[model samples]
Target chain A: MHRFANPARFLRIAKPLTPALFWLGLLLTLIACIWGLFFTPTERLMGDTVKILFVHVPSAWLGMGGWTGIAIASIVQLVWRHPLAGVAARAIAVPGATFAAICLITGSIWGRPTWGTWWVWDGRLTSMLVLFFLYLGYIALSNASSEKGDTSRVAAVFGVIGAVNIPIINRSVVWWESQHQKASITLGGSSIDTAYLVPLFIAVVGFSLLFGALVLMRMRTALAEMRIEARMRRMAQG
Target chain B: MPHAPFIIASFAVTGVFMTWLIVSSYLSMRRAEASADALREQS
Candidate 1:
């Protein structure tokens, strides 16, 4: 971890890996989406609306997973003072927020026909909304700190603290009886049918890879910006 | 198949947003790399 803390070393590996991950992720996601949309059997209850699960579930998972990345990166930045940790955290914010927003929108779209309403104040829904807002706040705070030329420690602290909502979002459906369905896929065993599970898993893996690729790309950009800033400072002093 | 519209909408939204993000990130990286190169040439 510490060895890769050097930006140049990180770039050496990331340069080749980024396009590979991006293309692979794109291929897999396309296959999964096609399979989920046309090949998979519709649910008896929800009919074709169940197809929404492929996108919704993955978005929700990545939405939470994004913040987890931020929290872990925050820990690395705060404790180990890893330079790339802050970069990793900042890189994740926009995509994470986008995933969170997608989750909310798709979930709402799915809910409209099933629940007879476009919105719900259910536990899962509400907590996930909060998680989205947390991502927005982190993005704003991180940007502000960077603009002001302050250490990202404040944003890192916020990243770590904001993680408290993750668990709440995960357990919300279980803890409270809500309009949202309880966890269909869990450690105990998945209640979902095998047909649905296969495409869903593929979608999740593809999206996760895409998420990783996006973060790496953003981190590379951030690193480049950092180098430019340092050069400008040196030129100014000289 | 009655809920086809909803399914299509969900996928459309995800597709559009994900594409935008990927393209935007790639372009930003390209711009940053170009600027960095210019700076290196100047120095």
Candidate 2:
């Protein structure tokens, strides 16, 4: 862990890994999308709108998963003082927020025909919205701290604190009697039938790989920027 | 049973956002690397 904290060493690993992840993710997602859109049978109850599940569920999962990445990176920064941890946390924020926003929009679109309402204050929906806001707040806090030359500890702390919402977002439907359906898939088992389940899993894996690629790309950028800043400081001192 | 528009819209939005993120990140990485290289040359 500590050895890889060196930006040059990390870049050596990431440079080769990024394109492979990106291409693999793109191919898998393309295959899954086509499979879901055409081959899968429509739900008897919801009809073709059920196809929306492929993108929506993955976006929602990655949204929360992104923050979980941030929380872990935060822990690394705070406890181990890993130099690259803050960069990793910062790198994860934008894509995470984008996915969170996608989840909300897609969920709303799915809601309209199914629930007969475009928006609702249900536990699942509202908590996910809160998660989106948390992402925005973390981004703002991170930028501000960087500009002020403060240690990223503020943003790191916020990342850890904001992680409290993840479980709430996950279990919201379970905890409250809401219009939103309870978890279709759980650790113990999934209620989804095989017809729908296969492609959905493929989509999730594809999207997760894409998400990983995006984070690594951004982390590389962050590392480069950090190196540039350190070089500038050294020149100034000399 | 004609919810095709909603499904299309969801996929379209996701594709657009994900593409934008990938392209933007790639461009930023290029710029950062360029600047860092220039700095290294100067030093």
Task: Give the DockQ-based CAPRI class for model 2.
Answer: medium
**Lowest-sum lDDT 10-residue window in model 1 chain B:** B1-10
lDDT of 2 by residue, A28-56 (tens): 89999999999999798888899999999
Give the whole-model CA lDDT for all candidates, comma-separated: 0.93, 0.93
Residue A11's lDDT within candidate 2 is: 94
List ranges where model 2 is wrong by over 4 Å.
A147-151
Writing each residue's lDDT as its tens digit, candidate 1 over A153-186 gives 8889999999999999989988999999888988
Please give the distance, in angstroms, between residue A9's alpha carbon in candidate 2 and its true position after superposition: 1.3
Q: Candidate 1: deviation at residue A236, Å? A: 1.7
Q: List the residue pairs that clash in candidate 2.
A: none
Residue ranges of candidate 1 with Cα displaced over 4 Å: A147-151
Candidate 2 B-chain TM-score: 0.86
Tens-digit lDDT track of model 2 for B1-43:
3698899999999999999999999999989989999999988
